[model samples]
Target chain A: MIVAQRKPFEEIMNMLKGYKKVLNVGCGTCVAVCLAGGEKEVTVLNTELDMARKLKDNPIKIDGITIERQCDREYLAELDSKVDDYEAVVSMACGVGVQFLAERFPQIPVYPMVDTSGLAANQAVGWYEERCRSCNQCVLGMTGGICPVTMCAKGIYNGPCGGTNNGSCEIDTEQPCAWFMIYERLERQGRLDNILELHAPVEWLDQTPRTLVQPGYKKVDPEDLV
Target chain B: MKSGSNLEKVLKAGHFAFTGELGPPRGTDAEEVRKKAAFLKGNVDAVNITDNQTAMVRMSSWAASLLIMQEGLEPNYQMVCRDRNRLAMQADILGASALGIRNMLCLSGDHQQFGDHPSAKGVFDIDSMQLIYMVKKMRDESKFLGGADIHEPPKMFIGAAANPFAEPFEWRVHRLAKKINAGVDFIQTQCIYNMDKFRKWVKQANDMGLTEKVYILAGVTPMKSIGMARYMKAKVPGMDVPDEIIKRLQGAGKGKVAAEGINIACEQIEEFKEMQGLAGVHLMAIEWEHKVPEIAEQAKVLPRPVIE
Candidate 1:
């Protein structure tokens, strides 16, 4: 899931200083499960902002709402009628959601309340660890299901560098060496030959902005309609 | 004559070779490199020029190698994968070759976190194994990594590092085999303080017949003090400094630590001379280059084999 953390309170407060009225929007997906930008978090942020602003001479009003997945257009359409009532929109969703909301409401200023970190697995109730880089090319099939792109400090292929010390990365003794784990897993499975094969340099498919279209769905060209 | 380099000739002639290391200055002081090279001249077969070792910025290995070459010493030009992509690596290889450098050591450099620039992004476009394969392609196949024909491909004596002391102890020898299969002509191991572990690792390689495919050079570094040994044991990655060596250094007492360190290094060199399947010793007198001559002389590897 796309893991994100709320931006520092001071930065968020500074972005909302000039506004007299604002709408705090939250997402019900990844951020919600991570306890970052869920419905309860929006209510808490709105109350704190209200109290903090009231303490100052310049007070502001905020309305909080949590929608089901802000990435989809259908969920976003529900905010169309009520969005114009606000002077600015504060999005507690991931970067993608903020951009989508801003695209829908072009007149109102949209500010991000959270920083999108990475695609991660929820290790525990409140802990998350990055598991994938979304590099568009996956080599997990050969790497014993451990993602070197996300695990190794250098993201090296072929094998462990000379920096593998006692099963930990050279960057930090606390971090496990990705290639060490790969070698051990492959050795256990009797597929050690997989690691022996040379892996070519990554193609960097994510170097440019990427857009995906489903196999059955073709992007319609406006020129064809014309 | 794959590279026709002095080191290659010495190893090919079945002579036990001796190589020394020269770390380029942190600044662009060519004289510092020459000064260090002076001690190694006629005392060692080749001098390894490190490239931003430990991720700290320093004079480039290519430039330092050329400087030492001007001092009439053969340079084992070292190249690390942490700072260059394929384009820069290929360009540097061609330039180094044009400058008359024959030996090149490929490595995956230390992580940038340990360097002066901790925030700098490391460009590991190719690992050490891939770098070896690429250099081999440029030399033997006369082709670039992209398969483009070169006008005059660099004929380098390809070298790679093997850390037999690192983790997954059983797999270290297998990793060496992988490097050999990648077309590495020579191997320089991590510094050996645990002789028993190193003996076992080398015996495994010898049993697998890997010693015949590639020349293995045992890496050795003299501990300047007891603190240095402890730092290497606790801090440095992949370093296997045994506690007994530290106890020995401490036993040397106050003012005699440096001499004791050199004495220990000389003893290791003596053992390396008799070890089967071991081709040579790469003495890395880090920051203490002046002592290399005495160490070589005491270890009885002096008057290095002159191959014509």
Candidate 2:
């Protein structure tokens, strides 16, 4: 799931403090499931703003609008007539949605209301823990389905490293050392001997690295992408 | 000044004031409601008598307000549009005026799904905005939002709610402005724990013209116990409890936590009272009734604002 944290209130306030007409736009895909932006959350925000403005002696005019998925242009196409109603749009979707909205409605400045944290999974109800860094590598197969690249503090490919003590990693006591989990899993599967074998070093991609590709068989799709 | 002008006086009071909430009983249990009103009197400026609070079936806000008034306490009647049409609301406004329940807080009411009766048909013929507009029309223009003339106009001090620390932060400020434009006279916010967030929201509200037109009351619910604190943070959708407060409450132990909770509440009230453009504080104690007095005392808010 796409994980995000709410933008600092001061930052958000500063960004929208100039506008009188505001549109709170919610996205119903990843941000919705993660509870960052949804119909319920949007309504909640609406109530808070309503109350705050009432105190300052300058009550504002606010409206709410939500789209199906902002990553796709087709969903945002529905906001055609509604965009002109407000002076500014407070986007509750991910960082992608904010950029898409900025590009689509260049006239009205779009501001992101949430800081896109990272990919994470729900730890429990209303609880989420960061799980992946989106390192653009898949080495879980060799590590018994437990990712060492993302889970390791040092990102050590073949390491218990001297920093490991007991079952925990050195950097954070909250985390279990990735190699320790791998060792236990291999022992349980009667594949402990594999630990002794040498494996080649990995070249991990950093940042949001993008790549283009061509098909080997039928390559006509290059023109279709445009 | 006439007692009828107390609403304006109450609003005019420097920010850091206190209000209380009273959820009316299931039936016409005047004894239970009177007992509650007695518990709240002299301790709070206005006691909010809920109208079908939690969306469960209960005594109406108008009756509850009159009953509380009979028990010698000012009542802020909570009205919801979930079960009433424009006609009932219009008539109900007249009925409330006849009973001398002048202070009313307007709401769209909780959805049926959230309450015990999920299958109960909702009668949201008009939302809170339309109802507020109608009330304004009757009182200000002797007409409703539709411009229809009314034989008996009603007088009310209208208030609404806000939830500032909700997850999707950006949308809340603008939505608040809409309610102010809808003609709300005052606003009572959702239970707030994150004061830092609230300060920022207030600035944003000021920018939106929300603070210019409406009086605001910051809502606060004291955590009576550590267990209750956990429940409020995790279960209460909009209540965002800081980790430090949780740790503090945890370290305070059982007997000490209640006192600690009350102390924290007092500190918040003290801060709220001094804020620029702040109107007041709305205290929702849930069932922890008697502690409100002690909290008010500790906060140094005594000789309460009387409708002199």
Candidate 3:
């Protein structure tokens, strides 16, 4: 899931300073699972922002609401009636959701209250660790299911560089060396030859903005209309 | 005659070669490189000019290599994968070759977090192994990594580093084999203090018949002080310093630690001379280049074999 952290309170407050009334929006998907932006978090932030504004000489009114996944257009329809009532919208969602909210209400200014970090796995409650980089090309089949693109610091194709110290990366002793783990796993599986297979340099797929059309959803040819 | 380099000539002539290291100064002082080169000019076959070693900013290695060449010493030009992509790497290879540099050492540099600029982004587009293969391809096949023909390709004696003492000890030999398969002509092991582990690793390489494929150089660094030894043992990643060496340094009597350090290095060189499948010793007198001549002389590797 995409993990995001809320922006500092001061930055969010500064963005809301000019507005007399604002809507605090939240997403109930990735951000909520990471504990950054959810229904409970939106209510808490709304109360905190209300109190903070009241203490300051300039006071403002703020409303809060959380909808289902904001990435989908259907769930975003729930905000149509209440969005125009406020002067501005502050989205407490991943970057994607924030952009979607902005697109949904073009008249009102949209500000992001959270910073999207990375695609991660929820290790435990309130703990998230990055597991994938969405690099488009996956090599887990050969790497013994370990993602070197995300785990290795250098992200090189052939690794366990001389900096592998005691099965840890040279950058940090605490961080396990991805290649070392891959080697150990492959060795145990009696597939050590996999490590010897040279991998060509990665051809980065994200060089330009990429749009994916699901196989079944691609537009039919115009010739069909004729 | 792969590169027609003096280091290559020495190894090819069946001589026990000796190489020294010269870390470029942090600032752009050409005299600093020349001054360090003076100490190693006649003492060793080639001097390895490090490329932003330890990830700290320094005068570029190619520039330092040219500076040392002016002093009549051959340079083993070192390039790391941390700072450049394939384009820059190949461009530098052509540029260095044009400048008459024949020896090149490829390394996956230290992480930027350990350097002055921790926030800097490292460009490890190609790791050391890939770098080796690329250099070899440019040299032998006269083709760039992307398969375009180079009008004039760089002919370099490619070298790569190996760390036998690093974790998953059994796999280190296989890693070296992989590097050898990548077209590396020489191997320089990481600094040695744990002799038992190194000997075992070398034996494994010999057993796998990897020693016959490439020249192997044993790395030796003279410990300047007890603090240096302790720091390397506890803090430096991938370095293995045995407890006995520390005890020996402590027993060197007050103020005599430096001399004892040289003695210990000399002793390691003596052992390397007798070891099978070993080609040479790479002396990394970090910040202590002045002592290399004495260390070489004491180790009886002096009057370095002058192959015609």
Candidate 4:
């Protein structure tokens, strides 16, 4: 999912301080499903920004477009005819989609309107909560489906710290102890002995400073690939 | 075989308030074939078969229109610019005419993001205004926009949309002028609820000498209940319902709101009866089509006048 949080309106207006003839380009894939970069959201955002700009004595000429997917070169090619009409583009997508739009419309300045958050799932209609941390090694099979890296505070390798007070993490009182969840999950699977296995001290090098390079089935050249 | 085949003639006849719609099967069930043609049969002048309603993959509108044709219902097949370029749009207009789908509604169509599938491609190579001019070019000159000759000339009744209640009301009238200038034969407006604003808009059109440019059907969708009214006002972008009607629904018991909403619409039709220069009403009671004949009778519009 394209998990994104809206940039504050003040922040967005700050970015487009001097620009007129802006295009509020939306990405229709992941960001759209999340309701951040869809046409409806773009319309609402455009209204808000226009109201803000008008209050500031700046009447900006803004038009909108929701391209199918900003990541694909073919889809981005759809903007070729209309790009010259705009001075800048505000892309309402993840960081990846923003970069892709920038690469496609190299002459036009593309600004990001969303902050890309960690991988998450919608808990229900409007709530999104983090569920998985791609730690490069998935040990959910051994741990009975509890994701210790994401759920456990301090990224507990083995057992809980003494800070667990009434099944709550010490990091924050409302936070549930991840190790406790792992223990309960293991108990349910009839493999309580699994918790005795001592894990080695771990480093989250790849997980931190995350950079994803998906190997190609892409038809275009690497130089041409956005 | 003559100009009677043209759209303006069919609309100016004025007795039947004709409308067209596109219904892609909600699922892949094959029985939807007979169901579609049967639903709209004889209910209106023609049923519109949509070309990829919302850009989701479905049975093509041509095949669906052909099915409706077999069911003996005239199909007003709609063509959109999102899926084709001008050349393809021109080709499809000829193709539709050959297939005996006479009435056409030219649309720019909704963006792909609004549909269930978002990763699909968008080809908005032309807007609705440009498509109208292109259709006129093919019809009047027997040639393509580039001056290329055609083997046979094609003629069609053309229509576009107008929504005075859409935000920034001034722009809506501006767009109306553009559509009339583009040679739209008639305008099937977005669902209208507020008659006061609508009357003002008609006055503006008349003041600008646009009252006679193209036949205008004040599009109306009668709500079945308070829930339906709320949903329509919420989801159907350009549709509006007045607070008094909302409060009327608020006062009327839920069990009888359908009849109440129908009565409210019937009242609107009664008031619309006095407006001069009207073609007819386009009642889009969506899914409640069975109530149409009753509502028309309640509004005293039944035993439709024989006008030509």
Candidate 5:
């Protein structure tokens, strides 16, 4: 799932500094699951802002609403009727939600309260490790399901760099070397030959800011293929 | 004929090559580089000019390399993927070659957290491996990364760092081989203290015939005190400091620790020379650059090879 964490409280306050009445919208999907910008987080932010504003003697009005998924246009439509009542909207969703909310209501100013980090999987309670880079071309099958593109510090397709020590990365001794894990996994699966195969240099330029259209669902643009 | 530097000639001639490290000053004092180069002038085949090693801001390696060249010492100019993107890196390579800087070492520098500016964003647009391949492409094919033609390409004897003590110890040799395949002409490994592990790694390289494919220079950092030994053992990443060596340093007491450190370094150098697939030693005396001559003399690499 997409992982995001809340901005610093000072930065959040600064974003809502000038606004007299603001609406804080939270996403119930990824952010909620990650305990970042969930419905509970929305209420907490609201209380903090209310108290902060009261202390400042500005006495600003703040409200919060949590949509099922801010990325979906249908879920965002629920806020359309009341969105105009607020001076500004603080989106506590991933980057997708902040931009989608802005596009849905162009008149109202939308700001992101949480910074979208990366695609991650929960390792333990309140702990998440990044697992994907969305490189468009996935090599998980070749690498024994480990994503070297996101795991390796260098993101080299071939093998580990000289920085691999003991099984950890040279960047930080605590972090495990991704290629080492890949090799071990492949060897355990009797597929160590995968390491012998050479991969061409990745074309990262063509893979970024990519848009995908599901066939038979969204209209496909022929020009996009070019 | 790439770079045609003295280090390249010595290694090509299969003479036990010796190189030293010169860390440029944090300030804009070119004399610091010259001073460090002077210490290593007659003792080493080449001297490496570090690029903000450990993520700390320092004088640019390209400028320092040019300065070291003026000191009559061939500079192995180092580049890190921490501050520069491919565009800047490509331009700097061309500029270094135009300025007669011969050798280049590519590295994915330490994270910014270790540096003065912890808030600084690391620009790892490409890793060191890709940087090597990119530079190799530009030099051999005379083409830019974007497939643009280069009228005159930079000719450099490329180098990269290896840490045999790093984990997944079984994969270290294969990792070195990967760098060699990526167009690294030579490799200078991380500071070595564990002779047993290094010998095993070198043996693995020899068995795979990777030793014949590329020159492997073992890195040696002479410890100054028992405190430095303890600090490296506890703090330094990828450093393998055996407890016995610590005991040896501790046994040396306060006054003799420096001399004891030199003895330990010399012992490692002796073992390194005998190790299969080892080409030479990259002496990183750190702030003790002046001790390099004495250390080199003791290591029996004093009469440095001179190549035209």
Candidate 6:
């Protein structure tokens, strides 16, 4: 799942400046699961903003609501009737949700309350870790399920840089060296030969900002759709 | 000489090859490069221009290297995989070669966490070993890493760094062998404050006959003071300075500490000359470039052999 963290309270409060009525919209999917943009977080942000405004002597009315998923137009349709009640929206979702809300509600300004970190998972409660780089090419099968692209500090496919010491990364001693982990795992699986063959450099050109076209589905122009 | 570089010529001719490091100034100052190169000239076979050593922003090593060449000194251009991708790396390699740089040292740079910009991303598109292979391919096979023919590939004498004191000590020699297999013609190690451990590593290299395959130059950095010694022991990662050395430095007393540090480095150099498979010494005086010639003379590496 995508991992994100809430913007600092002060930054969020600053974004709420000049707005008298604001809607705090939360997403129930990845951001919610990561505890970044969940309904619980929305309530906390709403309360903090109210308190901040009261302390500043410029109080504004803020309402909080959570949709099942912010990325889908069908789920966002539920907010159509009442979204006009607010002058602006504080989107507590990933980058995708904030853009979607902006596109759906053209009249209201949408602000992202959370910073999208990376594609990661909750390792433990209150702890999240990045797992996939979405490099568009997966090498897990060759590396014994270890994603060197994201785990390795340098993202070098064929290493354990010289700095790898005792299976730990040189950059951070707490984190395990991805290549060392791959070596040990590959050794255990008796596929150590996989690392011997040098892999070519990553195709960065192909990994640039790209759009995926759903196969066999008619692509409709957004203006023509409505 | 394979690359016709001065360092390569010195090593090939069986002379004790001495190299010094030139850390470019943080700003655009060609005079700093020339000033350091002038100090090292005639005292060392080649001067290594570091590429943003310790991750601090510095003048590019490429420009410094050319400046050193202008000073009539061969510059061993150092490269790190931390900043550039393979495309940029290969292009720089070709450019360096075209501009009279013949010795190339590949390094896995110090992480940016130690630098001014800790948030900057490190682009280690390929490891040092792979970098060695890529350069060798370009030089020997006359082809790019993608197998496209190069009209004139760079002819470089490949070099890489080895930190024998680093953890998994037993595997250090094996790692050296890996670099050798990747086409490293020479190896310069991390600073050696722990001579006993370095001896053990050299023994392993000798046993594996790695000495016969490539030239190994031991690294030496003279400690300026007891405080500096302690800082290196405690703060520097992969540095294994024995308590005895630290005590000796502390014993030097304020008036004679710098002299003691040079004496210690000279002793290491004397010992390295006798060690098996050891080619020579790479003196990295850090900010004390002025002392390089004296250190070399005291170690009796002066009057460098004039190769045919």
lDDT (0 to 1) per candidate = 0.92, 0.74, 0.91, 0.70, 0.87, 0.87
Error of 3 at A115 (Å): 1.5
Per-residue lDDT of model 4, residues A1-226, tens digit only: 6588789888998999889789998888878878788787899889988888899899788889998888787888888899899899899988888998887778989899988886788888767877676778777887788777777644545434323334566445588777666666776788866755334334345535665567864345667543
TM-score of chain A of each: 0.95, 0.85, 0.93, 0.88, 0.93, 0.94
lDDT by residue for model 4 over B180-212, one digit each (tens)?
Answer: 777688777777788888988887887777867
Best by TM-score: 3
- Candidate 5 regions off by >4 Å? A123-127, A153-159, A162-165, A170-174, A197-199, A205-208, A217-226
Clashing pairs in 4: B7-B157, B21-B48
**Scoring only chain A, what TM-score does candidate 5 earn?**
0.93
Comparison by lDDT, 2 against 3, better one: 3
**What TM-score would candidate 6 get against the native?**
0.90
Which CAPRI level is candidate 3? Answer: medium
**Candidate 1 lDDT by residue in tens digits, B108-160:** 99989999999998998888988999999999999999989999989799999
* Per-residue lDDT of candidate 1, residues A58-125 (tens digit): 89999999999888788998898999999999999999999988988889999999999999998899
The CAPRI classification for model 5 reads as acceptable
Candidate 1 chain A: 10-residue stretch with minimal lDDT: A217-226
- Which residue window of length 10 is worst by lDDT in model 2 chain B? B1-10
Instruction: Quote the lDDT for B190 in model 3.
Output: 95
Off by over 4 Å in 6: A54-57, A142-144, A165-168, A180-197, A211-226
Which residue pairs clash in candidate 6?
none
lDDT of 2 by residue, A1-226 (tens): 8877667767876677778889888999888888888777778777777777777766667788888988777888888788888888888998888888877888988888888987878888678876677667776767787776667654545444333434666445567878778777876897755544433333436535565355665445523532
Worst 10 residues of 3 chain A by lDDT: A217-226
Give per-residue lDDT, candidate 6, residue A139.
90
**Worst lDDT 10-window in candidate 3 chain B:** B299-308
lDDT of 5: 0.87
Indicate the residue-level lDDT of A206 in model 4. Answer: 54
Q: Tens digit of lDDT per residue, candidate 6, span A74-113?
A: 8998899988998998899999999998999999899999
Question: By lDDT, is 2 or 4 better?
Answer: 2
